[model samples]
Target chain A: MTHPPLRSEAAELHLSHQPAPEDLERPGRRQLSPADAALMEQKVRKVEVAISLVLRVGVLVSVLVIAVGLGLMFAHHRAYLPLQGDFSYRQLTSGTTPFPHSMASLARALARGDGRGVVVLGVLVLILTPVLRVAVGVVSFLYEHDLPMALVTLYVLAVLVGSFLLAGV
Target chain B: MTPIDFVVSLALVSVAAGVLGSLVGLGGGVVIVPVLTLLYHVDIRLAIGASIVSVIATSSGAAAAYVRERMTNLRAGMFLEVATTTGAVSGAYLTTVLPTQALFVLFGVVLAYSSFATFRRRHTDQPLTVSNDRIANYFDLHGSYYDPAEKREISYKVVGTRPGLALMYVAGLVSALLGIGSGALKVPAMDSAMHLPMKVSSATSNFMIGVTAAASAGVYFIRGQIDPIIAAPVAAGVLLGATFGARILGRVASTTVRLVFVVVLVVISLEMLQKGIFP
Candidate 1:
């Protein structure tokens, strides 16, 4: 549970004459020379930068997916017309006919003016978003060597599962 | 309920909700529910169900940016979620079984409380406390952020862990019963109690409220309360609105924004109280 004490040049200058905690450790902690400490900080910074880059990419991908999905939905809805297709306008409008229960039902509902289809699609997007968000979070935790947050992500999934089961939404 | 009519309405509502919800930081549920029930004459239960879906959309859209910036404390959010989800389930069940008048009364009271809380003075400059959590250290929960105002990297530890988490449980319960996003309470608990920075706490609260809503939304869905006709516009509106809000977050003076939010909350609270007392 011990962590390496974080030190910056300013902090180091303030303690130039004083011994570090590592100097007072029981087993005589291995002291990193100033050069080594600087190297370590550089490595941490590199890792941080790399992690940030990956997260940025992830955000972009998520946004793209959502945008495409919404676009397709809009296009399809606008193209749908009554009397041109076999399905009557009545069938399209009255969402309660319980049309074949499948993706077709969703599609038909959307065509028929059942706004619920849009909602279902919206929910799908919502679900995907958290997955992407947690993925990015996972990468960040990995870079930070934060196993607890990583584990907590798994726990979040469990909460998701429990919520699904208990709320049955 | 015709398909063509439904599609057009759904699209329009979705777009509106998305734009407005994004602007206000609410998933647009607050606005959507009233619109559906009062304007469209949809049932309240159905409107709530639709509103729930929109909450999910708003959170999902916004959570990623927050996560990437490391503004969301994943551990704190997940830990508090256990309480929220459980409470949400109970609240959902209560919503189904409670008398309409009683539910309205409770909802009104909660809305009023939330409105008052929103306008209250917020303490944002509190120093962070060191956490004694072995797991926190093992996981490197402590971190530093660049404070633009201070022009320094401020490092901090997560603290008041137990109390903060306990509060989330209550937050979840309220979220479920009321069907309102619980960010108002969750943000304060994390920032004021757990000692997270204001921005981080707000982002984390946003991340957590979705799961809370999902827990209850599922229940409503199963009960056949989720009329997609109603849900479609609500979700679409919220998603659009939340995204817009995220973009503008950094552009405005936060204090002014907060004051406006408080004023809105007060107005909404009074409306709810009037509805309950009169109805």
Candidate 2:
């Protein structure tokens, strides 16, 4: 008897149904028994939920920071005041955009409380969301005792960090 | 244009790009790059920098909802990411060494062919059930998702793990070299080579593209390519649009998704061809 895919199980991992006992015995197939598959799905679902939360929170925070920065720019920066027909950001696009693009410059700009600096910070946060999601994956995989996957996730994190360091160089 | 006019106008355009991108698994960079460079007359480098940020915003924003809905295959996405990130780093290094104009032409031809092939099979939504691949089974890369359009649960197994990784590596390399998320390549790699259902392939591609983009994004950032005044609105708008797009994906049929993706693929291929031939 097959079960209706329960709403509770709707978010479960890859394997959602049970393989017949004989199906598990099929050589080279590596089918997990129904109960074991359920357990694995449960664990995977936990990790997925965590990752979802991380993504949602990261994006929300970054968007909020950007909004605040935009507000600050309009409120304090005369150059950005609305409907100034004489003023155009066209000059900024012509290689004079006053914004931080590197860590050192970002740090300096933040110290000065520049609105562009705040916006850059938010951009950085957006870039880092995927990196943070990978970090969470590493921890969760380890907790699940999936060591090979834990190591795989760790390697990905290393590559991501290495890319950052090399880019700085 | 005035800063206010600039920000609001660009944000509105980015919202459209984000909705289309999130729905099709292509990131907003595809649309953002051309619009910024051609329409806004922004420098190509700064446009690329901003587009990279938009790609991440699309991925993370749409992925947040996709994962929660079980549309994204987490294990498959994570496993494929290893290959893509490595390829991205290597491609970044090779950028100074490779004749990218020729590569652009080559990939354009490849994409044109794929767009044709994808259109031919647009109506097939059947997910494969049997798989003998030890690597896929060992990694538990198989998955199932509830399709609201079909009103049924779809279960599928992954095959061709090694081939899928190879294709993803190439996709990542192209993305890094071109400064766009190559989800056009990624979706086919997953759907054709790995036999993931079309929706699964799209959602999983959405999940994976961010890491690939993020790898190159750091390099773009440090090179002073990213202009915050521009990138800020692009990111915010893409995120909002992606969130909205993710809601629509569940209700849309798989064939509709394929049709849309094919159309975008054709356009991108033509643009790529024009870039190579002209430049």
Candidate 3:
């Protein structure tokens, strides 16, 4: 029923992947089902390409935002330290933490065009690149009809979101 | 040093680290932490947070090209994520309870072992001589990619699926515990245990690290370790270098890559081992 997963399909699919379903469906289409699977495979390939683009764009966007922030920081203070070092970890036992109270506060600061906020937003985009990739992966697997893989990727995504939300609590 | 001067210097250093790390299939975070904490006198935990973000950046930048070339084993990567994600969550907690120095030494030993595993150089064109692997068969884990340099398609069959998955769990735990070791372990596991081709292993490793690092980066952010000024330029530099590295991965010889990996692994392992022993 599964058609042996591409070993057999490779010969036919690789030969002609351009023909649409309508072109191949002209009555008595012997290879219609395999063609459909091949089409599905091609669609899955698009998802991979999309994932690649998302990662590339996300990183560049983050870099741009961070660069702008650095510029602003230097414009404000061209001295010993352009920005505050409050986020730096002192030690485990020091207990005097300077981390922002929540993600919302960080976002608010970013909206206010604070230099540090812009910088953090860049890092935020960097972190989200992987999360976005995993999200696309779920769609990729489902398109391939590979339910198990979809479930696995979905679970990984869940772990990421859950850990972020529950880390402080 | 002025803060602007410090960030500039750190970003410059990170660019080279990113290039070398990405070229050898180890993301830049491995070296970033050492440079920050030891050379610049940054807090170890703060260096860790910055490096984690850099790992995601490097992985993301490299994965774009690697995955597009069809070298990454998507299904295999997904299957292993189940193990990695679970291991990562547990390892995050382990950080609070365990003696981290001893764990670092242990992971350093593992790195040494991995270096030895990949020390040999083999021709990349040689076909994977595997057969009758039941799990890989059902999952269709085998893949093929066109080698522009070799002027042919390189087909390979993935064996040791279960071992690969189990090793990923260890890699994830070690990564969470150590902050950059996970990405380095992936290629070795794929190359030795799974008998995957070197190029495929590295590319898949690139594809997988972002997800693994993301699992922990979140915790680092919430804990107040990810400093924007520190993390930003470092991430940008690493991402830039990794993007360049990914484009050339298809052209570079596997033998050369393996030899370079062995050298980097030995140096990093010795450094980590030394730190653990002295600290």
What is the CA-based DockQ of model 1? Answer: 0.16
Q: Taking the tens digit of each residue's C-alpha lDDT, what string does model 1 give over A49-161?
A: 55335534543453444344445545665544452454433443233523222345657866765444554544544544454444555565566564666666666556556
Q: Candidates ranked by DockQ, best first?
A: 2, 3, 1
Task: Encode model 1's per-residue lDDT on B1-279: one tens digit a residue.
Answer: 344455467657666665545434455576667766776666676667667777776666565444454555556676667566666666666666755455555555554554454445353354354555443444444555554344466666665555555566666766676666666456555654555665556556667777677666556655555654344445545555565665554344435445555554565566556666787
Query: Over the stretch B1-279, how does candidate 3's per-residue lDDT look in tens digits?
Result: 557667778889878877776777777887888888878777777888888877777788888778888878877887778788787888898888877788778777777767875774354335454434456655567778876567677887666666667778878887888776576778877777667778788778877777888888878887778876678678878888887887777887778777877888898889879879997
Clashing pairs in 3: A80-B3
Clashes of each: 31, 1, 1
**Model 3 interface RMSD over true interface Cα atoms:** 10.3
TM-score of chain B of each: 0.78, 0.98, 0.94
Candidate 2, which segments miss by more than 4 Å at Cα?
A1-31
Each model's Cα RMSD: 9.4, 7.1, 8.6
lDDT of 3 at A125: 82
Reference-based lDDT, each prediction? 0.55, 0.84, 0.74
Q: Model 2: per-residue lDDT, tens digit, B36-122?
A: 999899988899899889889999999988998899998898899998999899999999888888877878877887687677667
Comparing 1 with 2 on TM-score, the higher-scoring candidate is 2
- Which consecutive 10 residues in model 3 chain B have the weakest lDDT in total? B123-132
Error of 3 at B140 (Å): 1.8
Error of 3 at B151 (Å): 2.5
DockQ, all models: 0.16, 0.32, 0.25
Candidate 3's error at B90, in angstroms? Answer: 0.8
- Runs in model 1 deviating more than 4 A are A1-122, A131-147, A165-169, B1-25, B94-118, B122-158, B271-276
What TM-score does prediction 2 earn? 0.92
